[model samples]
Each structure stands twice: as C-alpha cells, then as structure tokens.
Target: MQRIFAADIGGTNARFALFTGHEGSLGLDTVVWEKSADLRTAEDLLQIMQRQLQTPLAEGDMLVIALAGPTHGLRGKLTNGPLQVDLGGVGQRYGLSCCLLINDFTAQAFAALTPRGAGAKVVRGRALPDTESTQTKAVFGAGTGLGAASLVCCGGEAGFRHWLAVPSEAGHAPFAFVGAEEHAYQGFLARDLGCDMPTAENVLCGEGLSLLHYYLSGQFYYPAMVGEQVLSHDTPTLHWYARFLGRFCRQWILNTLSRGGLWIAGGIVAKNPQCVEHPAFLQELAAGGDVGGIVHATPILLTTDANSGLWGAARAGLEHLRGQTLAASAKG
Candidate 1:
C-alpha cells in the first residue's frame, strides 16, 4: 500500500486527509481541520497534521493540494485569502514521490465521482439517462468566493475510462444586467467596489450577500445575520439573491454545456438550501429563452459535505500515482 496526503485549502479553512491506497482503492485514515488565517505556509499545516498521524509521511508518499484559485503549474495562491503554495518546494522539503496542485473547484469536480457526490440531493431537473452518463458535468458554489469547474470523461470504456476536471475562473467574468432595476444594482456594485465593471464573484459571494442586503434594506450587516433573516422569514432580499444565483448558475450550465448534470457545492446554498428551493430560483433557472427546455431538464444537485474537497484531493493523488506507474511500465 502507498501513503497519500491530501489537502483542500480554501479562503477561510484548510482541511487535510491521510489515505492508504493499493491499486485503485483508497481508504481514508485521518482528517484534520484548521483556520486558514492561523497558518502562514503549507509546511506549517503539514507539521500539525503529522503530529496526529501514527505513521508520518515518508519517501514515495504522494501529496496533493487543492487551493481556491487558478493554479499555474506547481504553484498557486488562494483567490480570496493570503495563502500561497509552491509544490516543488514542498516536494523537495518532504522528499515525496509525487506532489500535485489543483483548483478547489477542480477538487470538487473529482469528488463528484465518489459515492458522497453521487448521493447529492437533486434540487432541480431529473437525473440523466445512463446512456448519457459520459456527458459533461459541472460544479459551482458561493462561499468566501465563487468557484466553478467541469468534469469530462475522456475516451475509454468502463474500468479504463479517464476523467478530467477542468478548472474555471467564471466568477471573474463580467456580470450582466437586464432591466433598469438590475442596471441600477449593477451601478451600486461598481461604486461599492470602486471599479469600472463588476464580476460575478464581486456580487455573488459572502460579501456580496451582505452587500445585496445593504443595497435593498439599507442595513449593512454581515452574511450570518442576513442568512438568519432569510431562513427565518420570506424576505425580498432572499428572493433577489436566489434569483441572481439561479441566473448565474443557468449561464454556467449553458456555457459549459453540462448536459450530464450540475452539482452545487460550497456553503451558501448548502447551508441555506431554501435559496435553491425557492420559486424565484427555480423560475430564473428555467427562464432561458430559446434553450429553456434544455435548461429546465438539466439535473441540479447540492453537496453539503465539508470534507468533499479533501476526498477529491486524495482521489486526484491516487490517479497521479497510477499514471506515473503506467508511464514507468511503458518505459521499462
């Protein structure tokens, strides 16, 4: 068996998991959680995790880290916070066999392949037919920031199939406004941000939730307070927020052509499921003009597990180890 160390580091929290794998099977052994603000580097967090392990990481062990940002090669920085990772340095310092870096949403995409992801609640549309199981699937959610990724099955059959997770920065794309009312809201966001244009992330995350509440009610409160109000009663702010989220999700599905399905992850909708279950959200999602039928029929799932990112990282690491083994066999 081989040792696999995986981590999912977001803006607010970082999670680590240890797995024991042989062949294609992975057994999760340990998990740890820490506040992102407390740790300055990945190594520091690793040391903390090591203290809890009966068998610490050794040579030939694999390490995979998923971060909340666009990853370039072996290095990445969190989009919503001040955490940076250099995988090469980490690998050299730990004498690991393999070290990989990926986007947090990309990790979520991989998690979709697991039983936990398969068991997600269907919030909208019907499940895809088994014949179309190979079609593309998407995952996105709002938390400290907005995140998205798509999963595709490359050419292969059953046991030999390869899955790829394509990371997306769609949250950075320009948000669109339709009517005079929404146009005014857009202006409000721009002025609040002190920028020319507002991206989806600027108006769709935790801070955005608070900002939306402020824009509508003239009360500047935190997300927790707003979330409580939304859950406690039927508020206009809740309706508007749901509508905007639904609209954004609709655009993402269309953009990615996710005919297989779409899984909603992160804290926003997961904690406040009413957002996706509301009539306004459903109506907005199904309101596509010409392709309304397609949009309406797309499967929508919500994942509430907090450890999914860590599971995804471990899965990714096992795949990497398998690929390296295959390459070495070919060379031999």
Candidate 2:
C-alpha cells in the first residue's frame, strides 16, 4: 500500500493532509491548516507534517505541494509569501520515496475538470457541457496570489477523459494600462503602495481590493474584511475590480481559446461570487475590441473549490507515484 501527503500553500495559509489508498479509494486523513507567514522556512512545514502523520511514513510514501506561485519546472515560489526550496528531500526525513511540486492552479485545473457535481456551477454565459473533449478550457482565480491554468483532453478509457494542465503566471502580466483610471491605479501602486510595475495581481487580489477601495474612497479594509465590505458597500473600487478582472479573464480565456469553458476558482473568487458576476464584469468581458463578442460567447463557471488544490495535491501525487512505479516495473 502507498501513502501520500499533500499541501496547498497559498499567500495567506497552507492546507495539509495525508492520504492512504489507491486512486478510487484515496481519502484525506489528519487534515491541518496553518498560516504560511508564521512558518518562515520549509523546516517549519516539515515539522508540522511529521507530527500530523498518524503513523510513521513507510518506503512508498510521497509528498506533493501545490504552491500558490508560478511553477518553474517542478519547483514553485510564493510571491511575497514563503521561501521556495527544492522539496525532493521533504519525504527523506520520513523515509518516503519522493515529493512533487505543482502550481496551485495546476492542481485546481485537475480538480476543476473532474467535478464533484456540486462544486461546478455555471455562473455566467451558457451552461457548462457534460465534458469538454476537443476545445481547451481555462481556470484562473485570485486570492493570496493570482493563479491560472489550462486543461485539455488527452487520452483515457473510451468516453472517459484524461487531461493535460498548462499552468501560467498570467496574473503577473502588467495590469492592462488602457486609460487614465488604469494609469492612476498603476501610479498609486508604485508611488502610494510601493509596487514596481503592478501586475494584474496587484489590482485584482485581496490586498489589491483593499487598496483600491482606500484609494477610491478613503475607506480602509483588510483582505479578510474586503469581501464583506465590498458586498455591504458597493463602491467604485468594486466596479473597477469587476471590470479589470473582466478584461483580465477575458484576455486569458481568449488566449487559451477555452471554448470548453472558463472557470473562476480560488478562495477570493469562490467566496464572493457576487464580485465575479457583477454586471461590470460581464460588460467589460464583452467590451473587448475585436474579440469582445467572442468572449461573451464563452461559458463562465464560478467554482467554489478553486481547483481543489488540497484534494488535487494528494490525487495528483498518487498519479505521479503510480507513473513512477510503472516505469520502474517496465525497466525491471
């Protein structure tokens, strides 16, 4: 039997859990959550994981971390978050085989495709198809960090689906500087807020929303309170956020050509479906120059799980481990 440990490390917090069993039988055990800022180093995570284990790790145990940052190869870093390190040895401390790193959105993309049914709801455009076969699909969302990934069918059992995930750092793209409002936002981040160039993440994320509201109306709200405040008080900042995100998502969705659908997932987007579905968002999405009408035709689904990084990490890890097992078997 094989055991797997999975972690979803975001800008704000990290979720950790262990799994025991194969694909269909995989279930979470000893789930733990902690603030990422509190743990300054990888060693801190290792210690917590060690204590959370119900039993000592055995030879076939594996670890997978779905990180909030853009992944470089197999390693990823949290933007203004945690220390990035090669986690290959993360399991060595427990006598496990190996560990894997994937972008948090990559993990979500996997889960977004395979629905738990309740998690996938069509929030805009047309109803989601039963399953997307040929056309590519995109999943992008904002929270502690902005995340993005593309999913397309690859191969699987007849009628079943296998997917390939293409992860991206699209949020890091410079906030589209369309007009004076956009330019002013950029200046505020660089001068008033201390952002260098101010990517889409600075304007669309939790911290960005708080700052936007403050800049627009002198009201102060933190990330935790931003969601509630935005709903309670509909302000120009919220409008800007909706339109900006509308354009941001519009471009990415068009870039991916995800006619299968465009899924918005993650803590921030999931918690506040109101923000994503605002008329401003849809209006801006359809306001694109040449491709505006094209975007309006795309299905938009607001997913509560945001790729289900915590669940995907363990399941994806199992997939990686099993692939390794098969390769080794073939060689032997």
Candidate 3:
C-alpha cells in the first residue's frame, strides 16, 4: 500500500493529512490537528496522529513536513514552537521510503504554483500577466510569525515547469518605516516587546494586530478578538492594521521583486476583504513614493482557504514523488 502523509506545523497548531493517488492529483484519506503546546515533541505529535486518525503510518509511505521556521535537510528547529525534529528519522522509524522537512512558506509557494483558486485577488487592479516565459513571485504568511519565500518559474510543460522555491527570514529584518506614524509605532513596539529595532513580524502577525490596535485605539484587545472587526471591516483598528499590512506588503514586494504577484496567507489574509476588486485593506498598497507606481503594478492576492498550508504540504508531497520519478528515469 502507498500513501502520502503531510504535516503543516506552525507556532500554535499542527495539521496532518493523509492522501492517496498520483503526484499531480491526490485524494484526502484523513486529516487531524493538535495544539503545539499540548504536544511536547514531534514524536508526541505523531502519536496523537495515530490515535486520532485510527491508522498508523506504515512502510513505503511518503512523508513531508512543513515548519514555520527555516529548514535544513530533513531536520531543523521550529522558530516559533518548541519542537526540534529529525523528520527523516520519523520516516525511517516507520519503514518509509522518503521524507522531507521544508519551510512553511516553501509549501505556500507551491500552493500558488497550483491552479484552481489557490489565490484570490485582494487588491483592486489586474495583475500584469506573466508575459515573460520566466517570471518570479512572492508568497508570505503572517501568523505566529511572518514567513516569506520566493518562487521562480520559466513557463513550460506541466512536468517541465522549471521553478525554484527559496525560503526567507525577511520578517526578522529591521522594519522599514514609511511615515511618522510607523516610526512612532516601531518605537512603541520595541519598548513594549523589549527588543531592539523590531522586525516586520512584530506588526504583520496576529500578535502584532493586537499591539497595533492598542496603539491606535488605546484599548487593548487580543488578536483573536480583532478578527471579527477585521472581517466586517467595521473598525478604525482594522483600518490601521490594513494600512500597516499594505506597507509591509509593499516592502516585501519590492524586496523580492515578485512581479508575478504576491500571495498572502495565514490568519489575517484568510479573513481579508471578500473580493480583490474591492479590498478595504491595502488601500495604499500602491502609494509609496517614487516606487509607488512600481508597487501598483504588482498584483496582490489573498487565500480564504483555512487549510491553504495543508494544501501546499500535499503539493509538496506530489512534487517529491515527481522529483523521485524523474531522478529514477534519468538513472535508468
């Protein structure tokens, strides 16, 4: 029996899914989730999966795990969570054929690579189509932390679409300020968080939303509570949050030069304005100085799918299978 086992592990939660079928197309077998806090280690997570799914991982299965932090080979430490895992060992323990540990955003780039509503436009304006055979795109998610990555593609056959996925730690970089408001807020963040030169993740993630809301409204509210107001587009706090996010997006787009478009995922974006044609957020996405025109030309899309990361993990599994087949054929 053959199967694909994938996990999307973030700071707060771990989502697992099993799939059956070929690389390009996969069918879901079972999916389960566990809180990272509850699970002390990666092995604990697997045990929970076995119990919840009513199935144990078996031999010849393919495994892919996406983490919120940077990854090296099949082992790495989670930047936001407490698990330091050797994903390859997990596979070997179960007599699996292959295993991979990848950055969470790396998986996200694959989601954008797949067609069929993987992304929805959040800002008004048509994305400049990929006129060049080879083009670049950016995908970033804001959650427990800000995760970023780059994708390069030279348009061609489905199986031959030469593309590269590069992971980034852009959120840890110093935050760039566009105006006095941002500068003051930066100081406030540093003071409150007790950090020096706060990073973009400080304001772009869920916790950042709460801080931003408190800074503006002087009323403290948790990130979880801010979601409803953001969805309804009913409060100044969300407006400010949107503006701040727009600035962050512009910075990343410029940094990566993702002309193919920018696709944003995670908590905030998942609840962004209903349609790209009319986004309450990112109103000034195209408003930076000098390069303002350039930013306007870059398209921005948002995904409402709560399971986007999981979808990307599944795609990761498919690509892994695809790569193995190609390698074997070449050797033969």
Candidate 4:
C-alpha cells in the first residue's frame, strides 16, 4: 500500500489524516486535528505532522494540503488570514516525493463526487444522468468566506470517473440583489461596512448572517453570536435572515448551473441546521425569479458531515499517487 499525508486548513482548525492506497482503492485512517491559532507558518504545522506520522518520512511519500484560499501560481494565500507558502518549497523541505496544493472548495467538490456516508443530506437537484458521459458539477462552501469550484465527471464503459476539479474565487464576484428589500440591505451593507466591492460572499457567509440580522432588526450584534439567536428561532429577525440566506443560496446555485449540480458544504451551513431547515428558507429558494428555469437543474444544501474536507484531502493525495505511478510505469 502507498502512504500519503493530507491536511485541510481552515480559519479555526486544521485537520490532518493519513491515507493508505492500493490499486484504485483508498482508505483514510488515523485522522487528527490541530488548532490553527497555535501554529505560525505552514512549516510549523508540518513539524507537528512529522511527529504524528506512524513511520518516518520517506522520499516517496506524498503530501497534499487543502487550504482555505486562492492558489496563485504554485503558492496559496489564506483568505481571512495571512499565510502564504510555496507548494514546491514545502515538498522539498518535508522530503515528500511530491506535494499538491488545492483549494478547500475543490477538495469538497471531489469529496461530493465520492460515495459518502448516511450523514450527507441530498437536499435538492437531480443526480447526474447516467447516459451523459461527461457532466460538469459545481461546489461552494460558506465559512470564513465563500469558496467555489467546478468538477467534471466523465462516464464510459469503465463507469463514471471524476476528470477535473477547477478552483475558483467566485466568492469575490459582485453581489446581486433580487428584490427591493435585498437591494435596501445591500445599500445598508455598503454604507455601514464600506463594502464597495461587495461579493455574494459578503452577504451570504457567517458575517453576512450578522449583517442581515442588523439590517432587518435595526440592532447591531456580533457575527459569532448570530448562531445562538438562529438556533432559538425566537427572533423574527433571524427567521427573515435565514430566508435571505436561502435566496442568496439560490442565486449561487443558479450561477453554478452551467455545471451539473451545486454542493454546499462547510461550517456555516452544517452547524446551523435549524436555519437551513426553516420552511421560509426552502420557500425562498423555490421562489422563482431570473434564472428560475435553471433551479430545477441544480442541487443545493448543507453537507452534514464535518469531516468532508479531511476525506477530500485524502482522496486528492491518493489520486496524486496514482498519477505518479502511472507516469513512472509508462516510462519504464
């Protein structure tokens, strides 16, 4: 079996796991977690990984890291935080046979393609048509910020195989308001927060929840505390805020429909099950407007499992190993 290291880095925490692969099968085992706040640089985290590895680091072992940011060139810079590192340098310093860096959303997209446990909730949208050979899929997650990606699956006599996972910074796209109320809220966000370059992420993420609440209720509150109010379901402000979130989600789903379906993962949606489960939320999403025709073609929802990123990182490492082995065998 081939051994590889994989990690998913987020704002609050970092999860690391070891994957063992043979043939086309990959198994993720010995999962571990660490606080990102405790570490300074990416290399500092690597030292911790070295200590956790069951066996000593070898030249042939691979390392794959999924970060919550955009990878410019071969380097990735964290979105909500400041941490930039070179993928090639990390590989060389760690004695890795190879190192692959991917966006957290890309990792999540790949994980959605794989068969998941009972925890994953398939909320809306149709499954990929078996007859169609290559279908494109889109993925997005809301946490520190919104992340998006596109996944393409090719089908043949061999069955469906994921071909590509493309990373995107779609969260940075300008925000669009569908109704008068939303436009009013957008104006408020711009005035209060000085949000000139507002993106959908600005009004749809965790911070967005707080902004929505303040706009609707005329009360300013911290973003972290919005969850407590959302869970109680006692506040009319939060209820309306959840509806707004659903509408924003619908917009994102429509934008991603050029692909086959849309997958929503990450802490914001997964943790606030009550908000996502609200009747108003679903109704608002189904309420058709521009691009309403495409809503039927796309799927949207909060992924249930918290370990999706870890699973995805492991899968990426295993794929990298397979590609390297295939290339080596062809050369021989």
The best candidate by lDDT is 1
C-alpha lDDT values of all predictions: 0.80, 0.72, 0.71, 0.68
Model 1 misplaced regions, further than 4 Å:
22-25, 80-82, 127-132, 290-292
For candidate 2, the TM-score is 0.80
Better of 2 and 3 by lDDT: 2
Candidate 3 local distance difference test against the native: 0.71
Error of 1 at 315 (Å): 1.7
- Best-to-worst order by lDDT is 1, 2, 3, 4
Model 4 segments beyond 4 Å from truth?
Answer: 89-93, 117-119, 125-134, 154-162, 258-260, 289-294, 325-332
Task: In angstroms, give how far residue 117 of model 4 lies from its true place.
Answer: 7.4
Give each prediction's root-mean-square deviation over alpha carbons: 2.4, 3.6, 3.5, 3.3
What are the per-residue Cα lDDT tens digits for candidate 3 across 237-275? 666667667777888888888777788776666755531
Q: Give the per-residue lDDT digits (tens) of candidate 1, residues 1-332.
A: 98888888877888888888776666788888877876666676567656655446663389888988878888888876777777667666766767899988888987776655777888976653333277888899888788899988875446535678888889889987778998999999999999888988888888888999899989988888778775445788888888998899899889888877889996778889889888888888867673746676678999998988887788778777777777798899
Candidate 1 vs candidate 4: the lDDT winner is 1
- Candidate of highest TM-score: 1
Model 2 alpha-carbon drift over 4 Å, by segment: 20-26, 37-43, 59-61, 70-84, 90-93, 116-118, 125-134, 156-162, 179-197, 289-294, 325-332
What TM-score does prediction 3 earn? 0.83
> Residue-wise lDDT of candidate 4 within 1-332, one digit each (tens)?
87878778877777887877665456776777877766557776677876765544553377878888777645786665656657657666666768888888878877764544213565665443222335566677776678887766543234334357777777778876767876777788888778675687887777777778777777767766777655457577656756766776777666656435566786676777676677877888788775647765555545777678877776777666666666698899
- Residues 176-259, candidate 2, lDDT per residue (tens digit)? 767887787688887866667888888888888888888888888897687887744466877777788888878987789877
> Candidate 1 local accuracy as lDDT?
0.80
